[model samples]
Target: MTGGTYTLLVEVPEATTISVGALGDQQFPAGWYAYTGSALGTGGFGRVDRHYELAAGDRETRHWHIDYLLGHPESRIRGDVRTPDSDIECAVASGLPEGPVDGFGASDCDCESHLAYAETGAELQTAVADAHRQARSE
Candidate 1:
């Protein structure tokens, strides 16, 4: 599937503050994070693969706000909730709870933020999955 909306499930093993380009240094606690994004351009869902590489230390360039978090050695991409052939980035993000960082991935959109944080992986995953489902049904 390609050209869709996706939510990445990430885990931060330890607390740390990182500089997120123009967003400046933001504190991230040790926990799970869900980042929603759209892949409607040329490569489509292939963008998720690039994200995987970035999180795995196989890539270096930091192109997006999420890149800053993914680039950290302690952070990793666990899984993702994808809505193939759908474009509901903002809707899905809105359904989830607000994240710690403001304007994290909504520079081009009106979303308060596209990243959500949770105390556990299960909680984050459930929230992301439910958000996607709700967005898709709409």
Candidate 2:
């Protein structure tokens, strides 16, 4: 499968809490978020497409922890950084600043969390890009 790692830059306009499936209720501060994930399965990058759909309110199924956050009314996808043909999800996630919500989108890995938060979209976007670049270099 031609899969890779990707970081979705999400924005939360207002602070709120959402129920993340088995993760239960979690707090989310108002800010920009970077969620790193792997698309190494047979569907490959299709998973990223699904995330956008969910964020756009086109989809209702919540299969991942990120979905819960993205499904929130005030949350939307700002952009994404992708490292094609690379499985550096964990590396990229660890490269960015730590996320406040523990275990978000990190059910399968050893990462503290696959989600990072920043007070501004620009800052989070830059961090996500840097993480992707660093992961690619490594």
Candidate 3:
């Protein structure tokens, strides 16, 4: 199994409010979002696939904070960046811009959030890639 840290690039078409599990209802502006997390569990990177399923409406279970956002009808998975065989989830997440929802996906760590947001896909994508590169070098 190939386990590592990964970031999911998400696009929200318009302003929307979604109840994010324990985080409750949170506002997400229309823009791009980057959610970072580790796939180091026994399931490995298969966790990423499950996220895709949620975004595609093929899955309904919301186990993680990211799942709640991805499950939203307006949320789309634009792309993803990955750093295989490494556990740099917090590093990469810390490198990106702060997310709207505090504690989103950082329940198990010290990070304020494992999610970040930007007004454009290009900006967030570039940030995600750079975060991965920076995390890997450390």
Position 55, candidate 1: lDDT: 90
Q: What's the lDDT for all of these models?
A: 0.92, 0.89, 0.95
TM-score of every candidate relative to the true structure:
0.97, 0.96, 0.99
Question: Alpha carbon lDDT of residue 6, candidate 2?
Answer: 91
Which of 1 and 3 is the better model by lDDT? 3
Give the root-mean-square deviation of each candidate in angstroms. 0.9, 1.1, 0.5
Candidate 2 lDDT by residue in tens digits, 8-75: 99989898988889989988899999999989889998999999999999999988999999899999
**Of 2 and 3, the candidate ranking higher by lDDT:** 3
Model 1 C-alpha lDDT per residue in residues 55-112, reported as the tens digit of each score? 9899999999999999988898999988999999999999997789999999999889
* Clashing residue pairs found in predicted model 3: none
Our model 1 lands, by Cα RMSD against the true structure, at 0.9
Determine which window of 10 residues in candidate 1 has minimal summed lDDT: 1-10
Q: Write the per-residue lDDT of candidate 3 for residues 34-99, one digit (tens) a residue.
A: 999999999999999999998999988889999999999999999899899999999999999999
**Model 2 clashing-pair count:** 0
Q: Which stretch of 10 consecutive residues in model 3 shows the poorest summed lDDT?
A: 53-62
Off by over 4 Å in 1: none
Best-matching candidate per TM-score = 3
